[model samples]
Structures are given as structure tokens and as C-alpha cells.
Target: MSMKRPNVFRGYAALICAALLAPGSPAAAFDAPARIEQNLSLNAQCGLRAFVHNLNGGLASARVIPLVSGSSAQTQAAGGASYFNGATSNIFSAVTAANLQANCGLADVTNLVQQGAAGAYAAAASISLTFEATRTSNGDRYAYRAEISGAAATTVTVSQTLVNAAPTVTLGPPSGPNSSGDYTVVATLSENSSDFTAASLTLTNATATMSGSGSSYTIVLTPVTDGAVNASVQKGAFTDSGGLGNWFASNTLSFSNTVEKTQKVIAQFMQTRANQLISSQPDLTGFLSGSDTGALNMTVTEGGGAFGFASAPDKGNGVWARLSGSWSHESDRKTSYAFGVIGSHVNLSPDLLVGGMIEFDFLGQKEGATRVDGNGWLIGPYFVARSPAHPLFFEGRFLYGQTKNDISPLGTYSDSFETQRLLTQFKVTGEIAQGRTTWMPSLQLSYTTDTQRAYTDGLGNFIPEQGFELTQAELGLDVRHEVLLPRSRGRLELTGGLSFVGSSAKGSGYASLVVPEYAGGRGKVKAGANYTLPNGAVLVMDVYNDGIGAAGYESYGAQFGFNLMF
Candidate 1:
């Protein structure tokens, strides 16, 4: 289905948007005071009449003052006032007239109802400002100089909440040493007023030294080459940055001579334990029917950097093989591309933890077919949060894609068109320990489109074109725990998961057979075991059986995979 249409098939279009907009979503919302929409002419004149207003009770100054002249006036007025005191800032006839006559280069100030604000407001306010501006006597756009001079009658009433704030920061290591084997520094933060929120920080001649994260700074100092080093700190004032102050920890860097190396690789193989079926399951034949999917990777460390590459091969159904390549420089890594005949995956990132990814593939057409082919691109943004010491973990992914295809034989081929697709998942995992065993519980959601399209061979040599959409609303509960191992070098884990799949499919151009089957909703259960090899390599295997099958018989399969990182 096109993005322009509603989701009658799966009805997930709205659901996805709502999910993305949910709390703790990847990106932050826009918090600008006004979404200004006007020509530069009016925007320029707006500078003189700007004022601050406190809508959330008169506890603070809510806006920045913009004036052309009288820096003295501003300092004596808004500057001296406590920013948090709520006030109704009005800059109308007085300031407007004065600014026009003094700095606007206007010959006269009349019909001026200028009013503007810069702080957060309960609701937007409008001022009917109409002032007579002076132009060059030549009647042509010449720069003689037009200045509007006068003291604008401006009155600002501000109310602010007196919030008690304290200086808080993470302590970081020090850099320089003081006399008597001591080092000293200071941190200063300005008291913020009600007008705005601060979002930035800066340090002078000081370097930040911290290993972890949070609202703290580490102050580490290297001992003097001939002696020892001591350190002390003092607090300073906080000044405004270009915009809102950032509300997060800060890290600073000094000279460093540290180089690190890292590498990661994942490989999986689907083992066919029953009659290697083909006629019934088409999409599953390529990867699922294969006995093994293998991959290997390695990296070298140098000047604070590293790189690696790997390839996983699987031969099933009419599909062939896939290979992946990646590289890393410190914390940033990128995957150039992954190419394969049936299914190809590409990841461009420093680590698997998260970044951007795109996977493309050509499926459907038989191996020796002369023409027919189905190809599409799946691209999306992803993020993952994990910690070795934390019991709770989270992962999220979002993907939007479009697909197009061509028919092989003239009469047998279908028409061609574009189809859009979306995929998103959010999961949270918690780890529980029971003696020698640890269990991981997780919650997740999977969403997809439920519509598709295709054309027939009727329209004048016009090959039949078609598309289809499918969706699975799955709710799952899973547990994974570490098992007793023989040695400290090797590890083992046991896992089990249950899921309920609700599916739907629809289309116009393609036949019903091509459409995905929702069939009857069913419960699926799976249990698996994983073992760690000697050289930091991990091996995993799992078996799953779903009671109800959409195409034919109940579906059951086992998968094995391994991962190596250094």
C-alpha cells in the first residue's frame, strides 16, 4: 500500500506513529517558543519591541529582551531583575517609539502598537504594530541613514517562582599539579532565571577525566615526573551558551596515547530436521532449509583504531549466499555493504549496538528463470542500550521501505508498481539470578503492513504487476539464563520464549495465493542452549514449534549460530 492510503489491511499506520511519539522515543521534541512564519522585513522590526512574560505564574522572566539602543536601559531593567519572577512584559508605544526614532533610522514614530515576547507562554499573544518608517528623501533605496529616535513607553511586569538551586556536577580527574605536590581547579555555574533553560557547559584550562557516565566529572592528575601531584577545586559562574543549556554529563579530553582494538562477527545456520519441504514454504526454503550459515571476522589495532570483515554463506531454495564487511575507528564504526543474490544485508556503524542499516534482496523468481524478479530495499534507524552490570536492558528499531519488481515472461509476467513497507520493534529485557543460573525476561512488539498489489497480463502486452502487505502483531515473553560451566574460560546459557502472533494480509494486483496468510492465531514456544568456546567465541542453538500454521502443517525448526568479538 502507498503511504498516501490508510491501513485497512493491518491498521498499523497510526499505531507506528503513536509508538514513535511515545515517551523516551529516540529523538527529543521541538521546544522553541514560536514557530515564526513571516518575511524578514517584519522579523527585523520585531527586535525593538521584544519583551519577557511569565505565563506559568508571575514567578520568572520568560523572555529575552531585544532592543536596538540603550544597553544601559536593558541592564537597569530586565538584567537586574531576578529572572524567575513572573512578569507580563509589554513593549508597546514607549519602547517602540523610542527605538524607531533612536535606532530604526525612521524619521517619525506613529501608529506603533509593537509588542513581542521571547519566553514560554501559556498561549501565544499578538500585538497590532503599525509604525511609519522613514525612507531616503531621494525616493530610491539609497543609504543616507534613517534613524528612529525616542524613548519607547515600555512596562514589564514579571512574576517568578523562587526555586532553590544547588551546584551539582560529576567530579573528574585533574590535569596539572600545584606546588607542594597538589593540583587545583574550580567549577562555576550561573544561577538560571525563569526566562530560559540552560543546556551547555564549558571549562577553561581544565581537562575532564572520567571513565563512566552521569552528571559527574572526574578530576585525575598525573604525578609530576620527579614527584607526586595533589589537586583542589573552586566553583565559578555559569554563563549562557548559544541556546538552551544541555542537561547531561560533560566529558573533556587532553593529550592521550591510548590505542584499542575490537572486532565482532555473527553467523547463523538453520538445520532442517524433517522432510526438506519446498512446495509449501517458498520464503523459508532459502535460509531455513540450509544446514549451516557460517561467518568469520578479525581486526588489528594501531594508533587508537581497528578494523574487521566477515562473510556468512547459506544456500537454500532458489537463493544463493550473503557476505558482510565492516570497519571501526575507536567508538565509531561503519558497514560499507553486504551483497547476496536472494537476500543481502548491509550495516554502516562502528558497532552492532546501534546506528543505520539497509538490506536489499531479489526473491521469488526461480533460479534459472529468464526474466521475472522481485526486489526491494529495507532501510531504517536503530538504537540499542545494554550494560554488563545492569539487570535491565532495552532495544528499539524502526524501518521504512519500498519495493518494486518486474515480470519474467510476457504473458506470465505481472505489471510493475511501487509498494511501501514499515517495520518497528521495541523490547525490554530484565535479568534475574537463581544461584548458579540467571534468567532474562523480555517484552516486545513487532509491526508490519497488511496490504499488497499486483497487475495481470490483460493490458496489451502489459506484464501483470502486483504487490502484497503482511503484518504480525506479536506479544512475547522469554527467559534466558546462564548455566553452570566446566571452566571459567567457557560459559553456557538456557533460554525459552513464548509468543502470540496475530497476522493479516491484503492486496489488489496479486492473487490470493501470493497474499500472506493470517490463518488462525497461535501460540509458539521455544527452548534453546548456548555455549561459549575457549577463544571468546560463543555458540548458540534454539528450537521453536508453533501450534498453528498459516500455509499448511505446524511449523517447527532449529537454528544454530555463533559470535566472536575481540
Candidate 2:
């Protein structure tokens, strides 16, 4: 009896299904909506049916929406593209469809045939200049609005349709270690699609196996040997879900293929930021005027990189003595550090000091995994001149550097290379003293260069030598406010400055590697305070935020130091 009860229930359901499937209750009426009252949005290109369903839904009279010959209305979609590229425009003639067929996902955008329809047609009733649109993440969107009336003048509600636009392509590096290894290069679209597939993309110089959804796909490629891999999609790769807007060509991406090569590229990147490159001078900002005999400093920069400074100024003998040790922790597991020593001979006069300096610098970099480790040394001579006048000061320094490096990107392979660098720096300052405050107007210029050199990677990869160059000019004003200390007869100097910074990293570092270039023309601010004791000793603390100083890189730091005078 329990089994029979189940059969009875099933028989009752059959009766209900029969009635619903009968005559006027056909499922097509419900599936193909008779009328849509609300705004219609779909991830497909806007087209005719979308317009009919929204504007003419259940209406008797059909609206003739034709883009007249030579007539470009703001509301029409052409090539499945928006007239405004996602922007709104009030002007009617200001819009033109970009990609009529593909952008609107329409096969026959006859209505979009501007030349064919030129002066051929016009809307009899009301027309909509702006309605709905198709959009891509980085591409244009298209839309239009219209009205349809019944034969008996019955009104149909106005509505808009949203659809998909052909997407732009981007070929990006696979999951990290961005080096020689088995990894997938991904081809991503600016928007999702119904039919965009791995088969839709084309590759050059490499055979690829691809996988993923329509919006984005991943591919593994064969070899181009030492060359790069390219990826792009041609027009007509696939159609939008609307059965229109055939896909268009995509942007091509050239990739450093499964690089199976050596680590020469990595070595080039690590060589650019060597300490000898940017740390052009010591902390000259704080003690440019006074004859502070010797000083010691410790400071930390952005990215947790730190450095220490030491200087000795012999007023009686006249010499520019300075030393610095800098070190930086891992950024993506890559680390670098440098230590240097300087010695110079000088002639001292009543108001002028002329000298030449010799410096030896040792530095090393570890490129974690993709490449092994590297170390190098640099020796240089600098010609220096200075006028330490009371109200004004002028200084010039010219340096010639010779460098050699040992690179071992593999456990069993290593090579040696030599290169040279040049640096020229100049500064001038004028001081105005009034009451307890002094203002110093300063201007500085600096230029540095690294020569190109050729080397063998020992792995059969031979490439041309690349060089780097950097230039800077800064004009600023520094203000010093002195406070007389009680009982100790000591004085505290509060100092601050603002500078307009300019850069010159235009063609620096590995061009082939697509390394991001530094930025240009910005502002820098500096603030500091120093305390001078009656014993001719001073304590110094300072901070600087100089983005242009680092040339597109973040360079900000705080330092503390002590100086003694004879």
C-alpha cells in the first residue's frame, strides 16, 4: 500500500504538467519575455533583439530605429562600441560607433550603416540619444535608447539594454620567480565573453597549450630558444552570447619565453643600484658651513635599508673626508650591501680648500634562486674644490670610478667583468642671518654614469653590454632657528627646507628587461635639528623625503649623528 501511494502522487503531477503545457500556456511566451519594464543588463553586446525586447515589448506599432546615412546619433551602437567610451555626452552628433559589428555583438548592424543610411532614414516618433551600453574593463562601451508604439497608439515603456564589448588582451607573467622555469603565461581579457577560448589566441615562435574561462586563460609554451614568446587574438575569434559582435584583434604581448637561458638579465638589474651609484656624497646638508672636525652617523631609509656615516674635516690642513656603509634587506629575497673608505690630500688657505680624494668601495648582491650571488669592488679618485666663506659657500667634486664584478649565477659557473663610472657634483649656498634665524638658499647639480661592458655567461648566452646614467638638479632654501639653552650655554638649531627636485634616469638600466623607469620632476622636504655644546661638539638629527632623489623609487630616511670641531 505504501508503494502504491507514491504512484498516486506521481499521477497527480502529470495532470498539472499537462494543463500548464496546453495551448496559450506555451513555455515560449514566458521564456521570450513579452515585455521588460526594468532596465535590461546582460554580459552580451547590445543588439536588435535586445532593443526590441526592451523598447517594443508587448507594443503593437514597431519603431523604426535606423542610423541614417552620414547620420551619427549619440544613442546608437556601432561596431558594438559606445559612442562616448563610457563618458556621457549631451550632443547628438558628437557620437560615432567605433567597432560596429564586434563592439555591439551584432552581425548586421545595418542600422549602424552610417554611409548606407546617410540621409536615408529618420525617427518619426520620439528618439533617445542615450540608453544602455556594453563595457570592457579597459575598452569602450556602447548603448542606445528607443520607443515602440502599438498600432492603436498603445504606449510601451522605454527601457535600456546592457551588453558586452569585445575585450582588450593583456599577456602577463605567470606566477613568480619570474625567471627560467616551467610557468604559464596568462592571457587576460578586459572583459568576460561567452565564446572567447584558448583556441581564440594565437602565439608566435612557441607552441602553447592553453586553459581557462573566456575572460582569462593560461598557456604553457614551447621554446623560442633565446627569443621571446608572443600572444594575441585575431578578429572573429568568437562571437558574443548575443550571437553578434564578433571578437576583434587583441593587443600582443612579447614575453621573455621560458627563458631557459642564463642569469645575465638578473645580474644587470642588480648592478644598477650599487651603493657607488646613488649615494653621491655624505651628509653635507647639516654642516656645510662649520668646520666640524669628525662626525659619526647612523640612519635608516625606506624599505628597511640602513647606512652609517663618518667624516673628518681638518680645517688646518683642508680636506673633504667622508665614509659611509650601506646595507639593505631582502625585497623578494634579494639583498645588497656596500662598505667604503676614503682618503684625500688637501691644501688649506684662509678661505679656500682644494683637494683630491681616493676611495675604495666593496659591494655584494644576492639575487636569491633564479640567479645565485654576486660580489664586486670599486676604486675611484675625486677632484674636489671648496670655498668655505662665512656668508657664502661653493663646492665642486668630480669622480672617476673603475669597477670589477664576479658573477656566479650557477653553482658550477662564474665570470668576471669590468666597467667604469663617472660622477660630477656641484653646490652653492648663500646665507642670510637676521636676529636668531638664518636662511640659506642653495642650488645643487649632480651627474653620474656607468659604462657598458661585455661578458660571457659561460652558458653560451652572449648579449651586448648595457650601461646606466642618472642626473639630478635641486634648488632649495634652508632656514635655521637657534635657541639659547639655559645653564649649559649651549644652542639648539632647528632647521628645515623645501626643494624642487628634477631627475635624469631616462635611459638607465636594462632596457630589454622592461624594468620600470624612474619618474621625473617632483618636490622634496627636509627637517632637522642640531645641538651644539660649549665644548665645540654637536649632536645632529635629520629626516628627508625626496622621491625625485630616488628617481621614481621611494627614498626617505632619518639619521642621527655627532660632530666635533678642533
Of candidate 1, the 10-residue stretch with the lowest lDDT total is: 260-269
Clashes of each: 97, 27
- On residues 471-534, what C-alpha lDDT tens digit does candidate 1 reach at each position? 4456667776776665577888788888777655443332232232434567789998877777
Angstrom error of the Cα, residue 315, model 1: value is: 34
Q: Where is model 1 more than 4 Å wrong at Cα? A: 1-355, 364-372, 383-394, 409-418, 450-467, 487-489, 509-519, 548-551, 560-562
Cα lDDT of candidate 1 equals: 0.37
RMSD of 1: 37.9
Tens-place lDDT per residue, model 2, 109-169, is 2233221111101212222323334443222344544333332232434444445455556
For model 2, the local distance difference test gives: 0.53
- TM-score for candidate 2: 0.50
Q: Quick one: best TM-score, which candidate?
A: 2
